[model samples]
Target: MSDMSEAPKLDDALGSLPGSRNFRLLADIPVRMSVEVGSTSLKLAEVMDLAEGSIVELDRQSDELLDIMVNGTLIAKGEVVTVNNRYGIRIVEVATAEARMAGVERRG
Candidate 1:
């Protein structure tokens, strides 16, 4: 870790950790983040037959934690919550860095 006593370099002062300079370069880049409740594959005909009020059963149980993904990689798991009348997620578990990297590799 970089010594906290020393002043940070002006060009990369935004990063507070060691190697943060490299991370700073990518800070402005945008990646899609999403929350997944559950997923299930259906036949083409079944999908086509869906109409208003149709119900689709997902693979996950109602009480199961949801997946929080960043750039298609699983980063955490959370449960849904209502915040000020809006939907939100309360993070329950965070994925290890190695696990996140493995997810990226699997996607790649």
Candidate 2:
């Protein structure tokens, strides 16, 4: 096997770039962004039993941070906020570039 330790880091690869033009080129590209409040899994029987007024419990606590995703990959965590009766997210933490890349790789 090759020495994996010899592989260049993600930061190193990015830092080696000569200019920001390559990065700027992608600035106009659009990506899907979403926020996940929580999730729960149910058996087929339970799923079928869901009704209009049914309440399903999620794994995450109400006070917990929500997952912020881009193109289905988690890139940050945030909390819900309300402004003028409109709902929004208040970003509390962001994942490192390496973490974001790792998420993309996992999904790929």
Candidate 3:
């Protein structure tokens, strides 16, 4: 019979695993998420001329829900809202599990 007592223990091998448990969570982790809304070539002068209640049309149509994203990845879509004097967005739709996984795979 052969002796197999020299192998390393499983817990010892995995004791140094990396994790995010101690990470600080931020609400807007992806600050550039809304950058890909698709409107291009609008000059700063033109942008500055815009005023409150002036509707600056976006690339998305009225029927299309705006893509809410994080770290440049689409996570959800929703309509804009104002609650308690604070701007908020209501999530009308969320990306599917498979779709989210695919994005992760692409990034990796």
Candidate 4:
């Protein structure tokens, strides 16, 4: 008969694993999220002449999807929607898992 007592035992407790516990800790951490509709550059004089009703065109078209940023990194694209008279974004596309992990690595 072969002796198998020398091998290490695998841990079954979730909290005993450093990676699992660390991720659980990070799950509670808050991150800032923002939605970008569009942006435009205007001269100082042009910006100063703006009035309440003045309209300034943006770089993106009105029908274009908005960008969803997490801690300043683009993670998804969405569109604006109204819910109960409040403005919100409906996510249309999300970044791949690899891309999202890369973004987190870059931020860290």
Candidate topping TM-score: 1
Per-candidate Cα lDDT values, in order, are 0.89, 0.86, 0.65, 0.82
Model 3, residue pairs in steric clash: none
Write one digit per residue (lDDT tens) for candidate 1, span 75-96.
9999998877999888899999
Residue range 1-108, candidate 4, lDDT tens digits: 133476444444445677976667676679999998889999999999999999988899888899998998889999987877999888899988788789888878
Write the residue-wise lDDT of candidate 2 on 23-99 in tens digits: 65675789999999889889999999999999999999888899999999889999988877999878799989999
- Evaluate candidate 1 by giving its C-alpha RMSD to the native, one decimal: 6.8
Score candidate 4 by TM-score against the native.
Answer: 0.69
Off by over 4 Å in 3: 1-38, 41-57
TM-score of 2: 0.77
Task: Output the lDDT of residue 66, model 2.
Answer: 96
TM-score of each: 0.82, 0.77, 0.48, 0.69
Model 3 C-alpha lDDT per residue in residues 1-108, reported as the tens digit of each score: 122477665455545545433222432254655523435467899889888887676676766677777665688888777877987767788989787678778888
User: Scored by Cα lDDT, where does model 4 land?
Assistant: 0.82
Question: Highest lDDT: which candidate?
Answer: 1
For residue 84, model 1's alpha carbon misses the true position, in angstroms, by 2.2
Number of the candidate with higher TM-score, 1 or 4:
1
